[model samples]
Target: MNTHPAPATRETGGAIAPHLRRLLEFVEPDRDDVCLDVARGRGPMPAALGPQVRHLTAVDAMPAHAPGGHGASGTNGRMSTVEFGTGPVRIADGDTPPAAATREERRPHPLGPDRTLVKADASALPYRDNAFSLVTARFSLYNLGDPEHVLRELLRVCRPGGRVVIADLVRGNLTGPDRDRIERLRDPDHPGTPSIARLTEMITSAGGSIRRLDVFTVERPVEPWLAGSCDDATADRVRRALIDEVDGGPRTGAKPRIIGGELWFTQSWAHVAAEPIP
Candidate 1:
């Protein structure tokens, strides 16, 4: 039997994470609204959301594919339980996988009793149509193989006049044949990053009307970021490429440069909110 390596768990820290706060601003959920967060890896957005919405549901793709599950072919089966841990919502340095928060840990939360968690595929969400007042996916598009399908599903579950918000890293400065190859080497499951223009096209094509779009640039250190998934050799190569960018030797569009004597890269993130045509 052949076995594949485990998918890289995206590091959920850095100043970029707080952009959800700005994205969620578009939703402006009321105390009565129902919210669904799709592809909510590691729970940063959900954590920020739990306190504001009257009810919340968070879902993620299980680490392993489900047998006869919601694949693109339209097969269906019961979803298996996989625990996606929760943590405090804040942007800071370092990767920390908070131990799965207990019910006791969650009780003090405002919407704790009303929150539900599910591990399933994004392409086929389990909820019914017009079920939620707001739907959001953060930092998830690049990892998903079919972002358009996921967007359509997001629109399907949203109530009439409800909003769908997405926050994702836009490919910046990094260009060339080698960019995708280097990223794949670091995290094999990384499909590839998308440009902002492509993302806008996907959202609009999925039958959503754009309400707001915000883009922000963030600077993050490279070594600590790469170390989360890459082996020594792979990390070495990535570091070399980034260093090359610093001296204008090559352009990976990772926007690498030396900051305070430490190597860092820049990424532009987009937060867009759209509504399905009523």
Candidate 2:
């Protein structure tokens, strides 16, 4: 069974991702809104939902394809149970798998009439101020350093009254940082995952007013999650760490457990929706 990952679409594994579906609903995209998705890690979002809007552009600092002659495609995806975690909405709404090819980035720019992929930095976007109605930075924020600077950039490009959605795997104090340590063990490129409150605070500090906040708990298998994120040896280490935690060693914060004899863990993600503080 292939474990490496490819960017997931709405139709990736023959079914719609429930979390993604809920996210789109929170975005509340309009037919005329121009959108920007930054650092599309695990999902080819613009490619999948491009036609749904006027135009959607995705930017990533890294190249479209992974380095060192890797092939495209992964094990599709694993079924997950997405449960709403927390946060109260004022009135409005709203992870990577591996290093794999996405249909948007590899091909020439403008994947379709309404979509384009560019290699750009989140901190220094190559766009005019207030150029988009909606800007999003998914699982990519933690991978890039300086959350405040990036959040400000995202808001700068988003026109006032427009919204910016930030989402990522958030770490909790009670859970500890062990899970994130394992994440770094798999891929050292990630700087850090911030707590849920920290992310929202950054948005406000970046000149954005919080409109809504939603958190979700995603339950998925541990093996598949590690498959493409790291090599076999590193994966083994991660397994040992999680297993040790399961064996009453310490809290991993990953909440690892056995489900039908398969190792599984739950990841908590936060989705913050905010508009410019105009």
Best by lDDT: 2
> In candidate 1, which residue ranges exceed 4 Å CA deviation?
1-18, 62-92, 95-111, 172-181
RMSD of 1: 12.3
lDDT of 1 by residue, 232-272 (tens): 88778888988987887878767676756778766566677
Judge candidate 1 against the unseen true structure and give its global Cα lDDT, from 0 to 1. 0.62
lDDT of 2 by residue, 1-278 (tens): 22222233354224335566567666666677799988744354665456667998877654323341000112312111224534321110112343322222445443576677776666778899989988877676655546687788888899876778877777654555556787787667656667777777788898988877777666667765676554788888888988998889877677787766877777777777887876
lDDT of each: 0.62, 0.65
Instruction: Mark the regions of model 2 whose C-alpha exceeds 4 Å error after superposition.
Output: 1-14, 40-42, 62-110, 173-175
Let me know the TM-score candidate 1 reaches against the reference structure.
0.73
- Count backbone clashes in candidate 2: 0
